[model samples]
Target: MKLYIAEKPSLGRAIAAALPKPHRNCKTHIELGNGDVVSWCIGHILAQADPEDYDATLKKWRMESLPIVPEQWQLKPISRTRSQLTVLRKLVKQADEIIHAGDPDREGQLLVDEVIDYFNISKKKKSTIKRLLISDLNLPAVQRALKSLKPNSDFMPLSISALARSRADWLYGINLTRAYTLQGQKTGYNSVLSVGRVQTPLLGLVVRREQEIAKFNSKAFYQVQAHLSLQVNEAVSFTAKWQPSDNCQPYCDEEGRVLVRALAENVVKRIDNQPATVSKLESNEKQQAAPLPFNLSQLQISAAKQFSMNAKLVLDVCQTLYERHKLITYPRSDCRYLPKEQLKQARGIVNTLAKSSLPCNKPAQGANTSLVSKAWNDKKITAHHAIIPTEKSPENISLNTFEKNIYLMIVRQYLVQFYPAYIYQQTKISLLIAGGNFVSQAKIEKQQGWQVLFPKSKKTQAADEQEQTLPPLTKGQILHCQQGELLEKHTSPPQSFTDATLLAAMTGISRYVSDPAIKKVLKDTDGLGTDATRAGIIDLLFKRGFLQRHGKAITATEVGIALINALPEMATLPDMTAQWEATLTAISEKNASYLSFMQPLTKTVTEMVYSASQQSFAGLPKVAFKPKRGKGNFKKKTAKKPAKKSG
Candidate 1:
């Protein structure tokens, strides 16, 4: 008997529907008409045992019990999901062959692999295990993947990498969190002070940004503007910014701000009503290609920017579209490009979506498929292709506003791939007045192209006010300066991070690092977390009370700031964690042994334990928070009230 095990029940149903002879019914396990059984795991049925599970005495937090590393790792079935485990064990015992139908990623590989290992331990003989890799849950995709099952041993490397990561996280998070929480107790701070490999560095980013903003002192500056009228055309008047003299270097900064008010006033007076001659004229036509399709991170960033939706909300919406409706491909992918061979499939998707009543009008109207985009390349494909709408039409499906918005975004990005590029003309004019040079720039849109589908808002239009149409003009033409004003402005501090900017920072953090080698390592490796887990990491920080969200902006709380200050740099810097990710990648590729990675991890934990022992929390501020444990287990000492003197 052939048994199929999927990652989730929804995927199991999809697979069962696609199998030959159809499925009679799907309940605990789908019994197909062809005598095959299909089942699924809700998620992980087994997890690595907690530290306390290793030894009952380790339940109480203690400094001496630091560096807790399990010698022989054990897996225990989750109490709430044990019934599913029982069902899976019963089916695995009767099966002659098993197909591992999980997501094509490291975590997915581990989720199903762990279950097989758990059930096969008691059996006298192991069933043949095979892997089914598919990008989407569509009927055709599922059938194709079923026909091309590979040996489960082919994915052992990825499963090993996932296992190593899980163990390492256990070693670092469980041990260090206990050590730090105990240290916080020394200062009367009654919080858990939770820490992780990625969570701490993410919090450090927010805390450092807040510190910089708090310490910033706004400085006043001034600039001169010339509102000039062209001699050739009366309707072609424009504003040109004044350039400071070379001798007035103190007034000019890198941002072109004139700090000295008196110098700026003198320049305004000197250039007032001055006759300016156009010394240089330059014009060039520029073309901008359509935006690439949505990766998980890019979708999160765009949703945050456009609709003020947070990262977690965006992921939830996309997941529904992918898993529930089956209207889109995988939502957890990191690649933003399609396979070159998928161009034909994309054309069919565009045609089917054009007839659907989706929220985005562009896909419904039609896409120009005469030209292909550079985004269709084979080498750019990673674990999965970009997030995109499937060939399925959503005409009869009911969708909420959030689902509609995200689905439209995916559809529009796909439709734009077939449209022509946006074309515009850039005009740059240089003016000579006094002893300095002034410049004016403008952009004229020649064709809306793919941008007709996504229109710019009023705020974006106002931001591009400088990009106005210019009349034809020749060089050396004298223009009349109508008026001049010295505008005073203060340098603004960096804005507090919003979900939009924070997501970008997490993905592109290598730009901020100073060390070249570490920066390259971080770039080559996925930043802080994978596209699939970054949102969860951010959510974890909020749930732990390490971060507070005010409107769209995120800030580190006092406890969070204190936690970073308390931990060593090696524990909080992203580069160090990124290096660990690089090592894990090497392990996955079989280029490095697991021992090489674990040895350094052991040394790092030992050093952190020593560091926690020597930390002095004398001046640390008391933060009001309770550790997430049983209330009566550990109590903060309360000072006794002073005795009355008049008694």
Candidate 2:
């Protein structure tokens, strides 16, 4: 029998649906009429063995066992998943050939590969294996993928990269965590100082941003505003902001901010009654195309901004849309561009959505299919395309509010591709007053095009440019200045990280780095973590008590802040992730070996152990988990009166 193993039951069922009539034999396994069996894993059936599994002495936390590097790695099936493991082991023993139908990523490759290797080791027999790399779980895509299954050995490099990453994380995380936790314990602080390759740097980002916000000092600045009435239309009035010249040293800055009180007052007095003339008036037509489709990070950011949702919730909702309802394409994608070949299917999807009623708080709008934008370029597509609705409609399916909201987001992104580009006319007006240049700008909506689809958040002149209509005027035209006033404003510090901004920071972290090489590598690679794993990484941080959420903003906890500060600079910096990503990429490309990557990581782990052992933790903030007590058994020490010390 040909056995098929998938990443999860949903995908396994989808695969079976694509094959001939499949009979459900058990909840965890299925049988096809053509002598084939299908099975799945919830996630990872096996995990790397912990240190205690290797040696009983290693079970206890001790400084002597600081850097635990196993001579040979081991794996054990997770207790909760042992039943499924048993089913897979039995299937492997009876099958003549095996098919791996995991997701199309490194982690997915490793998931099925590990299961196969474990069963092979147990049954003492090697089965012929083939890989089914399916991007979409829909029947057509699955059928196409089945016809082009590649030899499982062809993906050994991906498996190697995944294994290298796992071992590296274990080696560094175990050793560094023990070293730092022991150091904190020596200082009378009893807490686990958890550290991770990706989590620590993410925590460092939050801590550093908080530090900057805390230390920032606000400075007062002054601006002069004038309300000018046009002579052409007496009823038409507009506002212009004053721009100071470069010669106004010590009194004003290049941004036209008057720093000195006297200087600001003088400028206000000089320009109050001065005659103003229109120096320049320029109007140009502009066009803005529809935004690209939703990548996982982009979708998370948008959902967070629009509905105050968290990253993990958004992923879960999108997963439901993909796995349960089959309403959208794959959600764990990072690419924002769709393949050109998919344009044919995209048209069908648009037609399907046009006939369905998309639920919203208000009335629903129909989808327009007049034009398809450049988002369908094949050259830009990566392993998977953007998240869009499948060529199926959700007409009769019942959905909760959360699911409806997310489904609408995906649907809108797809419908936008068929709408015309947003068009507008931009106007820039410059005025001369008291030998200083004042500028005003406005935008006129020439065509509502794409904005029609997004009426609630439509872009208008006031919303986008913050300028009202300016009456018809020509150069050298005079205008009446109603009044000039000094506006006192203070600079504001950076806002805390909301899910929207934090997701942006994670995907664009390389922008903050000063090193060109590392930045380039990070730019080429997806930032910090892949779309499939970033949410889990963030969820882990919250579970570990390293981060807390206020409203929609995330802040590092005291323990989290302290942990980042205690770790070495190398561990907290994002360059470590970038470097590892580069090495992992090379290994997958067959340019580097797993040993080559692991050797350096092992050396670094050893060095970190030694360095952390020498570092002292004196004077570090000590937070007690228990209530504070007075000197002796809840009694305070009496203050001794100074005894006649005057002499």
Candidate 3:
């Protein structure tokens, strides 16, 4: 009997549907006509064993057991999924051959591989194991994957990389959390002071930004504008900003903003009613291709900005769209480029979109299938492709408001791949008036092209109002400066972190690092965390009372600030995540050894635990403890006595 073990039930059903007919669906396994059976795991049937599971002495959090290092790691079946795991164990023993079906990523590869390892089958049976990788649940995509099975041994490195990440996080998170929680107890703070490999650094980002905003000092600056007109046609006029020369450096700030009002006033007086000659003029036409399709991070940022939805909510919605509705491809992919072969399905997907009643249907109908964008490149493809709409028609499907909106967004982005590039002309003119230089620039939209698919919002329309349209002119042409105006402005402080900006910061964390070498590594990696885990990390911080939100702005609380101040600089910075990610990538590529990564990590953890022990968490604020309610804690409510005489 051939046994297929899938990552989840929905995927198991997808695989079952593609096999020979006469399917018999049981509670946990599906039986096909040809003596083939399919079973599944509920997410991950096994989890990493806790520190206490290794030894009874480690059960209690103590200062002596500062860094709890497990000599040999172990896996325990998660209680909730124990039944599903039991079914798989029995099936593995009975099967002649096993096909490992998991999501095509590092975590997914480890999820099933660990399960097979738990069975401890014969070496010969292990050698015969096959692997099935599926990124899309659509019928055609699933059928295509069925024909391209590969040996499971080929992905052992990926599984090892994931295992290293798991053990590293466990070693880092468990030991540090216990060490810090005990320290907080010393300060009379009666709560668990949690720290993570990724969450602490993320919280540090917020606290640092808040401090920067508080310390900012607004400064006043002045500018001079020349209202000029064509010499022949005085009716046609435009405003040009004055550019200060090197001689004016003493009166200007480092950014060249005029610090002294007198300097701006002098420029105004000198240029008023002067003959301004155009010293240089340049025009260039440019074309911009449509942006690539949504990766998980990009989609989360967009949803946060457009709908005021949090990162967790966006991920949940994407999962439903991918799994339940089967309307889109995998939602956890980090890659934004599609496989070149997927281009063949463009016409069918576009046609499906046109038949639907979506807001983007009209634009989808007009897509030119013959025009291919740069988004389709086989070289750029990673473990999985970009998140895109499936060819399945949604005309008869029932979708909620959030689902419909997210689906439309994905569809519109995919349709744009077939649209023409946005074309525009950029014009710049440099003028000399009374020994001072002035400049004017404008962007004229020559063709809306792909931009026509996205309607501008009110904020975008307001920005468009500032765009200027310069008249045709030649170099050395004379113009008259009707008058000069002096304007004063104040430099504003940096804005607080919002959901959108926070996600963007996490995605592009390289911008915040000071070390050049680490910054380059982070740029090449997937920022602070994987696309599948970033939302969960952010959500975890809020649950721990380290972060709070006021309206749309996110801020660190007093406890959060104190925690950051107490921790070591290495614990609160993003530099460590960069280094780990680089090494993890090498491990997957077989260029680095797992022992090399883990030994140093273990040494680092030991050092940090010792360092934390010596430091006093004196200023840490006391967290209010909320007792968990149990059956015995419940109190029945009594009916209030009638007070009817209140006339």
Candidate 4:
């Protein structure tokens, strides 16, 4: 009998629907008419055994057992899904042919492959196994995937990369968490001091930003604006900002802002009512193609900024749109470009959107289906394509506010692919007035094009004031400076981290690194964590009390600050994470071996354990532990009043 093991039940049902019909749904497996059966794992059926599981002595936290490295790793069935695993074990023994169906990503590949390894199948049987990769649950997409099955062995390197990541995380997170928690206890703080490869560095970013904000000293700066009238049209006048000359360096800051009030006042007096000549006038037409479709991180960042939604909430909404409604493709995809073949479905999808009740339905009618954007490129496609809307209409689908909003976002972004590029003319005017240079610039929109779909918000409309149109002027044309105005401004401190900015920082972490080589690697690898895990890692920090949210701003807690101050620089910086990610990418591409990566990692972990042991935690703050409430106890508890003073 042919057997298919899927990553999850929803995916199993999707695969079953694409296969030969006359399906019989059993308690654990779905049987097809042609003697084929399909079963699924509930996420991951197996997980790496914990440290205590390896040895009883390691169960208790002690400094002596600092670095516990397992010689022979073990996998234990998760208790919640043990029954489904049992069914799979029995089915694996009876199957004559097997097909491995998992999400086409690293974690997905490892989850399914590990299950097959647990079955202890013969090498001959393993070589015969086929792999099915499905990104979209739509029946048509699934059917297409079914016809293009490849050997499961072709993805062994991907599985191995995931395995290395898992073990590395274990060795790093587990050992450091235990070591730090022990250190915290020494300082009379009883709570667990959690440390992670990604989360700790993320916390460090917040703490450092807070420090920078606290230490910043506001400085006053001055500027001179020239109110000028064109000689050709006396009624047409515009304001130009004064650009300091090279000789003005002594009186200005490094950013070219005038620092001395006297210097700015002198420029204003010198340029007042002066006859100005237009020195240079340049105009250029520019076209901006619509942005590429949503990758998980990009979607999360947008949702956070537009709707004040957190990363975790956005991820959850995307999953619902992808899995339950089947209205979108995979939610965890990292690629923002679609395969060129996806362009063939553009007309059908646009038609469906136009007929739906979505917010973009009216705008969808204006989409030029024949106009292909640069977003369609086969070379840029990763494990899965961008998150885009399926051809399925949402007319009859019941959606809550969040789901509808997220679905609309996905549809709108996809619809933009069929729209024309936004066209505008950028004009720059440079003028000379009394030996000082003044400049004015404007962006005149020639065609709304794709921008017609997005109406400007109040903030955007306010920004447009700076780009007002300019009258016709030519170089060497004389103009009159009506007056000069001196404006004083002060430098502002950096803004606190918000959900949107934090996610953006995590996505483009390279900007924060000082080393050019490391920065380039981070840019190439796409930030600190994968799209599938970033939200979870951020959520985990909140659960561990490492991060707290106030309105839309996220801040580290006192304990969080203390822990960051106590750890070594390597533990708190993103440099190490960037290096590991680059190596993992190499492993996935089969350019690097697992041992070559793990050996250095193990040595690093050993050094970290020793380093952590030597660090003093005396300055760490003590934390009050909260007792766990029993189930069904929903009542709030009030603290008892302190007794009268014993004196």
By the lDDT metric, which is better: model 2 or model 3?
A: 3
State the lDDT of candidate 1 residue by residue for 58-157, as single tens digits. 7777789877887888899989889888999998888878899888777888899899988654443443588887777788767767887888777888
Every candidate's lDDT: 0.79, 0.77, 0.85, 0.85
Worst 10 residues of 2 by lDDT: 638-647
Off by over 4 Å in 1: 22-27, 55-57, 89-96, 117-129, 148-157, 229-236, 243-256, 270-281, 462-466, 473-484, 512-517, 581-598, 619-623, 626-647
Name every residue pair that clashes in candidate 1: none
State the RMSD for candidate 4: 5.3
lDDT, model 4: 0.85
Alpha carbon lDDT of residue 560, candidate 3?
Answer: 84
Model 4 steric clash pairs:
none
Model 4 misplaced stretches (Cα beyond 4 Å): 232-236, 624-647
Q: Cα deviation of 136 in candidate 2 (Å)?
A: 3.8
Q: Which 10 successive residues of model 1 have the least lDDT summed?
A: 638-647
lDDT of predicted model 1:
0.79
Candidate 3 residues lying further than 4 Å off, grouped into runs, are 246-256, 589-593, 623-647
The deviation in Å at residue 225 for candidate 1 is 2.6
- What is candidate 3's TM-score against the reference? 0.92
